[model samples]
Target chain A: MTVPPGRRERKKAATRQKIAGTALRLFLERGYDAVGIREVAAEADVAVTTLFSHFASKEALVFEQDEDFEQRLTQAVTGRAPHEPLIPALRREIQALVRHCTADSAAPIWRMIDESPALRKYEESMRLRHAETLATAIAADPELSQTATASRTIARFVIDAYSLAREAADPEAAVDEIFRMIEAAWEVTCPSRRA
Target chain B: MTVPPGRRERKKAATRQKIAGTALRLFLERGYDAVGIREVAAEADVAVTTLFSHFASKEALVFEQDEDFEQRLTQAVTGRAPHEPLIPALRREIQALVRHCTADSAAPIWRMIDESPALRKYEESMRLRHAETLATAIAADPELSQTATASRTIARFVIDAYSLAREAADPEAAVDEIFRMIEAAWEVTCPSRRA
Candidate 1:
């Protein structure tokens, strides 16, 4: 995927980042609904059409982050240490967020999602899609899928745990705690997880 | 605080059931958006205002069965065996849905919900509300709440598991599998329950 690096590509990338940052700032300052798309465009120093070009819609400002969340989780799943299971890799990703986001202003992005109905709707549906993807992955696994029915339940339960953890006041500790709980539940269901 | 054995209560119950049953039949036969208030009333042999008295909106008709769902789950929590943990009881109540709904009709209902963004919105919000109720109940339990943040994790995981079971294709194994998952998840999170 060579980009044939050029000024246009660099500028286009910059515009997306700029618009996203501006939209996030505006949304955090004045709740999601109170802020208008026009204001966001103006604040980002872009025309309305430019803003729309960057983010199709205002909701996309929030939803874009959500869409990326599952991708990152999937990356962790695929790139796990050979000895580690999927949950351990997932725990690292969430706990990493607790450190990185809290130190930055990105924490409000999560709060915005928790507070906004539209955003929550987008987030929940996106997680369902992620769970579905994980189900496909689990289904491909010869051992797990044989016993677990396509891994839909396991994937959904894990996503639900993560969603609840995201709502926690402390995402890092919450991640560790949730992953541990899920492990226990898995053990009870499979009994051999304790081993 | 028992109801006096009288016509009013009986009539009210009959009216409520009539409206719900009629709405389900119509929605099942003609699709949710195809029918209207006037049509529902005519089909139920009731006036428009009478229909309104029973169900505030069409969405309520779709979710009317959940009143009993929430109530029964809450009662299961409150009257749970003192020694039995909340997660197992929650598991049983969730598994019980299999005996009733059987995932046979789940695809249509899910399709109806998925097709109409409004129903999906309604169902998500309703689930959030149920999580809140379960959280409050879990919070009140000195034993469970004190151990760790049992309330939120328990509620969310149980719900995630139930949703998984409901969406599963096999009625025979879904509930048993999901319940096993939830209980196992709870044990992992709760120190006392962990192996």
Candidate 2:
């Protein structure tokens, strides 16, 4: 039951995509450090203010999917099928994210991020923000019955799983292995779930 | 057996301490962002090169104990009492660290770190590096016999405990609560420990 975006919204979305695509192309061609926001805006045929309006900073441009990534994580908790276990839902989402980022097409962008101190720092703080958002969503679910501490702890662990799996030699296997540990951790918080 | 440092080594240590103390004072007096590296060196009465030699960056001065922190975590694993369970040993170490950072004396330093984006990012990366070193120490213990993934996952959970607890309302209690989850996570990886 969602309304379709009107023309104005559609145009704005298109502009954002074009700017992000153009910025990524320029960053990859030249070094991230070498490229300026002005250059990105000029090459994208947008004003400097327009670029800033869409993205908060140069680092934000590189992490074009930051908001989407955060939303997906929280939704995995809030949008799961009723009574389905929490850790598995989170594991499935993390597995998908690891796959998306580790795909061959995404290699160059990650390499560029790893090489830039600015980008790496931005990504770390971005992950912390996502973890906090996920914690809030988890705490809001009455059925989960987690204490504030438990909710925050589980959220951080889920975020850690995604990050650690992404860097592992085998991302899929790493997700399963880490999720087993998370499942055990989660279950310990539920005394009723134990024999 | 431990030997005291020679005079030259003692002098080098004193110089390093003076530079770090001076830098921290300036960073606190002026905002971290307002203070510059050259100003720190000048105030400390060291050549710019001498300051650079002792500390890698402005951020490094803020985290002067980074190496010591990493070493202590690794030593918690590699130098534990024989037959001591891994999770408890790590829990003890993490508790100590949380207490150290949460002390009233350390509040200003941590406040400075939280207020500065550069310092926060630096701390995140430093935590990751410490986790890796702890993982290596855990994996190398023949008695533990964990897979590489398990060792790494546990290492991250321990590091997360320290961080989450440091920010919690009751830091000491948070450390204990998170360690309970970590203990459960670690036990799952050790099939032999269960009936």
Candidate 3:
């Protein structure tokens, strides 16, 4: 899916981010309902039609940040260190977040999404999609499909724990707190789950 | 919130279940959107107004059975065996459901819910509320909130795992599989997680 490193793709990506950034700022400053699509389009310097081309609806535009962590998760679980069980690999992923925190990252998006029920519901739907991606990825493996439910269940738990931590912490501390909680859950599930 | 177990409350409960049973049978046999609320009211032998009294939406009438589990979960988590950790206690509660499985119980309900996106979204929202309820209960324990994020994160993970196990099982074997995955996750987190 990687577009070749060229101006067209880069410009498209930047325009997409611009619309998102503008939309988020407007939603935060006023409210999700207070802002209109035309305003966002104008602010982002894209035509309204172009903005809608990038996103199906205002809800989709607001929820654009809900990315495929499941893809990263699939990467984490499938690309584990030799002999490592899925749980430990996931535990390490959660822990790494705590060791390094990024404030100008996805936190504001989550914060804004959390503030609105429509957005929260959209994100929850997105969460189901993410879980499916995880389950589907695991189910694809010959050794994983039959046994994958358990691993996927554990993955869901890790992801859920990671979510709660990310939501509750101050941005600077979100990563570490998130990782610490996941590691604790990891310990409870895999008593020997190590860093 | 406990209504006194008098004739009126019992009668109301019976009426509610009857409406739900009627709606579910209709939703499964007919497409959820294909059937109208008037048809459901007619079949349930209740006025449309009466059916609406019991459920906020037709969706609620079809999903009435699910609301009880979260109430039970909140009760169970708050009142676990004195010696057990929260996750194992939660696992045992799910384990208890195996005995409740029947040829005419939750299996059909689960199947119907799985097939609909609206229902799936509704169920996830319900699960988040359940997680929040359990989190609030756990947070009340002074020792937990003092730690800031770990306790709430653990509550959400445990709830997520419970939700996963519930959704992933074979219909006939769902109860057993859910608890089994739960116990497995518990063991992975806590090697000694036991009955």
Candidate 4:
């Protein structure tokens, strides 16, 4: 059901990956701020203009994967059955994403983000933006549309819960624990429906 | 039951206030990073050492009120009646704090925080720290002790709910709405207790 990229698209994707990898390496070796865009482009054997075309900014380069994650979240929420509630859909989708993050390939990128203050800030801001977007989706539901502020808070809570789960030593155990805690939280906040 | 400050203690408090006010004014006019400790002392008519005695660093000066807020949260949580449930106690305590923050005098300080990236980051980091401390308090309760991660997530949820309420046009109304949202969230997460 998915279309494969043509030759030009494949080459463009390869160039972007190369540039980002090189930039991350330079950032790790020296420091994020110390590494110049020009240097990263040179090291990656790409033109500065080409690098800029691929990524709007250095921060964008580092956080390129975040877009995909956000998209998945949007799809998970919007594509759910009309009767499905927002919170459960979010929990299931984010848990899958969190599980993927625990894979071997994600370690380096996670470390890169952990070590850089700029990246950390970027990540935090992106998270807030994502929550806002998700809240809009939640509010689109007729039942939830009336509680706009509450919807925003719910979106934020789900994101924060996932973040906490990810920080745990055993993420899978943590996910189960977080869901239980969320249920407890729900009991006090709303008693009408069992989430 | 509280002891009043002696003459010397009152004078020390006054001096600290003068320095902090002057520092805030300067930071607001110029920028957080642009304003130096020496400049703040000069403006406040205090020596550099005197300012240092009151505040260890520039960031500390900006976040003095935040420390007080955190202390109050700790005291409220720890000082609750032995029979009180953790979630209800926190909800009551933080709602009081949210009311205090809604005062007209507090608007400028909130704006200062909103305007500065450094201050925003400092605020976020403090929120996380407060959540961690509150989580400890929540975990100390026997019923919740077994789920440390859940306690943390609950703590974060409370703090974030408070933040969302504060941003609304009517903070008190928002607080009420947020509590309802929390109940809804609790319903989904844990339906047994109607906290």
Candidate 5:
């Protein structure tokens, strides 16, 4: 059982959401490069220091769900049903993520990211970090019995599936195609588990 | 047959090499972020415009071999001996690249890159571009006859092998191990080619 957040925690969450929502609106309205942090803070009714407290940098504001995204990926490995196969779990998660990102609502945000070098660079490094975290989670699973290199490689391949699928003409089909490859790659690492 | 360059081209090539060497030496000594473009041009005894012509950005100075690297990856696909298998050819090229980047002489340059977020981001994007070129080469090959998605997925896996191997404790072994997985992944896309 989980304890619900206290009042203080709830207020902090509200503040962060407001800041992020305001920043995204400003960025989309005028252009990511045109907007300034001070302007975002002013418009959000938060101090510059408060904005910094919430997000590490302007790039961080644009990727407000960075931590959440990382956590979901890791959890998809660690929190799956007992005896659930790893590749399928990851495939489901990636499919959902591709759906979320490719939804019509997210098009403008991704367009902004593709157009701006700063955002693209930031997203690249962010994905690398997520891949590393996922690697650690995969390595820690005793049931998988994969070598360190295998674990890391599969993690990167899964992350690549997400990235590649997002850009494909048919994101869902791309995920399925890529996961079929990943499933084969994973089975090779554990010959005993081959069906 | 390849023809030798004329005098004008030879002179241009020499100037480009000199500028790259000078900039690298300075970056290694004084640090990549601390050195200015003007300082590098002055030290190389070329105008700022000439330096810019040779390298598009300061990050480009550190990665002078970027174009060469991209070309070599694509060539590994396009220029392989007739009837040579695809996975092993890519494995050999990636093995060579990992060796080049992991050499003692290349340690300091990679260290500098790891220390700077900007350089890490630049390298990430550069690798993406190389992956796309590789995918295109693979898709254009009549013998492979892979779906565009499979070609692209395998291209990313090959690039990931290079990157993950570079950071591994035993880069050569890492390359071999990762390629085993890639070989399996590739075979699944071309079931007819499976042994």
Candidate 6:
């Protein structure tokens, strides 16, 4: 049902991945602030312009998945099955996200982000934008739109829970705990309906 | 039942206020990062060493009320009356804090904070500390502590709502709106409980 990328698309994707991977390695090795963009381009065997074409900023390299993550969260709510409540829809979306971000291969990257203030601030901005994006989607529905405060509150709570979960020692346990908390939040805001 | 400061204590408080006021003015005029601490000290008619003694860093000067704000949130939870619920107690605390921060006299200071990334980051750090402090207080109680996720979720929800409220054109309305959201949260999390 899906069409794969053609040669040009595949080549661009490969270049982007290579640049990002090389930048991450260099950043992790020499520290984010210390590593220059020229160094990354040189190490990646690409021009500085090519690196800029791939990523807008150094922080963008570390957070390469940000846009995809935001899209998936918005789509999860907007694309929920009929009769499915918002909380469970979000839980499904968040579970997948947490799994992806917490995979075995990503541990070092997560640790790197934890140690860097620049990355943390960048991550925080992304987190706020995620909440805003979700909020807009939630507000599009007439039923949820009427309760603006509650809608934004719920959106923020879910995102914050997900971010907090990332810090847990056991990602699965953290995800489960957050899911339960979401259910509890749903119970208060929408008492007549169940998640 | 409260005691006022002695003459020496009062003079120290006055001096600290003068330095903070001068620093804020200079930061606002020349930008946060551009303004030097020595300039602030000179403007306030105090030695640079004296200014350093009062505030550990420039960021600290910009966020002078942060410690007081955190203490008040913790005390609100800890000092709730026997029958008072957590939500209203937090509401009362947040309302007072919001009023203090959003006063007409504090508009320029808030605007300065809004314009400066360093100030925003410092404020975000303070906000996280507030959540941690509130979570610890929430955990001290037997009922809510059982569910760690819910306790933290609620704490974060309260803090986030308050921060969002500050951006409102009419802060009073925003405060009221946030309080209602808090009540909805309490209803969901603590169903039969009154707090």
Candidate 3 vs candidate 5: the DockQ winner is 5
Q: Write the per-residue lDDT of candidate 5 for residues A1-195, one digit (tens) a residue.
A: 259888889899999999999999999999999999999999999999999998988999899988899999999999999889999999999999999999999999999999998898889889989999999999999778888899999999999999999999999999999999999898888846534
| Model 3 per-residue lDDT tens digits across residues A94-190 | 5554333235675566567778777787778776677667666655645333444545655566656456545654633554554544444334434
Ranking by TM-score: 5, 2, 6, 4, 1, 3
Model 1's TM-score against the true structure:
0.76
Per-chain TM-score of chain B, candidate 5? Answer: 0.93
Q: Give the poorly placed runs of model 3, Cα more than 4 Å off.
A: A1-26, A35-58, A78-108, A135-146, A170-195, B1-22, B36-54, B79-88, B98-104, B139-150, B169-195
Put down candidate 1 lDDT per residue, A12-105, tens digits, no spaces: 9899988888887788888898998889889889999988877856777876665566677667666566646656666677677556655556
lDDT, candidate 6, residue B151? 71
Per-residue accuracy of model 4 over A1-195 as CA lDDT, tens digit each: 249778888898899899988987887788777889999999999899999999977888888687888888888778988767656777788889889988888787788777876677667767777887877877786644446676677777878877888888888787776765554444444435633
TM-scores for every candidate against the unseen true structure: 0.76, 0.91, 0.69, 0.77, 0.91, 0.80
- Over the stretch B35-98, how does candidate 2's per-residue lDDT look in tens digits? 9988999999999999999888889999998989999999999899988888889888888988
Q: Deviation in angstroms for A180 in model 1?
A: 1.6
Enumerate residue pairs that collide in model 3: A98-A175, A98-A176, A187-B189, A188-B189, A188-B190, A189-B188, A189-B189, A189-B190, A190-B188, A190-B189
Clashing pairs in 6: A188-B188, B85-B195
| lDDT (Cα, tens digit) per residue for candidate 2, span A84-177 | 8788899999999999999999999999998998898788889989999999999998777888888999999999898888888999999999
Give each model's whole-structure lDDT. Answer: 0.71, 0.91, 0.66, 0.76, 0.92, 0.79
**What's the TM for chain B in candidate 2?**
0.94
Error of 3 at A44 (Å): 8.2
Residues B3-60, model 4: lDDT tens digits: 9768888899999999988998898788777888889999999999999999866777
Interface RMSD, every prediction, one decimal place: 2.3, 0.9, 4.8, 3.7, 0.7, 3.2
Candidate 4, which CAPRI tier?
A: acceptable
Report the TM-score of chain B alone for all candidates. Answer: 0.79, 0.94, 0.73, 0.78, 0.93, 0.80
Per-residue C-alpha lDDT of model 6 across residues B1-195, encoded as one tens digit per residue: 248768888899899999998988788788887888878998999999999989877888988778788888889988888766788789878888878888989888888888887778667767877897888889788645435655776788889878877776666676677667566655655635442
Model 1 docking grade: acceptable
Model 4, position A101, has a per-residue lDDT of 86
TM-score of 4: 0.77
DockQ-based class of model 6:
acceptable
The reply for model 4, stretches above 4 Å from the true place, is A1-18, A28-42, A45-61, A115-118, A181-195, B1-19, B29-60, B181-195
Distance from true location, Cα of B100 in model 1, Å: 2.0
